[model samples]
Target: MEIPRRLPSQLPLILYLFFIILHTNVATTDTIKVGDWKEILNDTLVQDLGMYAVLRYNNSTGSNLSFYAVFEAQAQTVAGLNFRLALQALDADFPRLYKAYVWEKPWENFKNLTSFEPVLG
Candidate 1:
């Protein structure tokens, strides 16, 4: 079989691009405990500024979350659930997500798609 003359020249560029993509996605997740949170949450959020209005306390579930560790875990779990929910909501834009929902082959890298739906709720 005859090979294209340009194939050899493009090989290095292809390999370079592959390595660039691989290295760019290599990120480490750091888990910070609630006790160490004083440093992280210091004056960053709006709530840190002033004394907010008194929130009504309704003691329903026994999980008071008085211990910050419990609060952190609950917060992380809610955030993770919200992320998955957002992903599912994205699928809803395509077609009947409630009917024949599709679980696609997930990609490691992020993708961009645009959709618009009028807000009713």
Candidate 2:
């Protein structure tokens, strides 16, 4: 069998490129898949978080908003867990839609309202 003179020189470059491609794909896959939001079926925890979000917002803004019901919820895990909720509330006797982001560390008994904003049409 005859060996090509350039084969040895090209082998290292091919292996190096293959490894680089593999590493790049693994990293991208991890980053994209980590912390994906998942739907939460209605439960006690979801209800509590929904109420907590409204209560915190009302307290901070001094707005007389009352917690009504949570329409939908999703959760994501990060350093802590994040609760995203679409909830209904009463503002001056009219129902309104709200989006709330709550971050909670259950082990530490720590919870914070990250964002609360009314959803517009």
Per-prediction TM-score, please? 0.24, 0.72
Regions of candidate 1 where Cα sits further than 4 Å from its true position: 1-4, 28-69, 74-121
Give candidate 2 regions above 4 Å deviation: 1-33
Instruction: Report the lDDT tens digits of candidate 2 across residue range 14-120.
Output: 99999999999987773323399988888988998999999999999999998999989998888788989999999999999999999999899899999999999
Best by lDDT: 2
Q: What does candidate 1's lDDT look like per residue over 20-90, in tens digits?
A: 88777754435544323212232322121111100111123221212111011111122111111111112
Q: What is the lDDT of residue 88 in candidate 1?
A: 11
Cα misplacement distance, residue 94 of candidate 2 (Å) = 0.2
Maximum-TM-score candidate: 2
Q: Pick out the ten consecutive residues of candidate 1 with the lowest summed lDDT.
A: 49-58
For candidate 1, give the lDDT.
Answer: 0.25
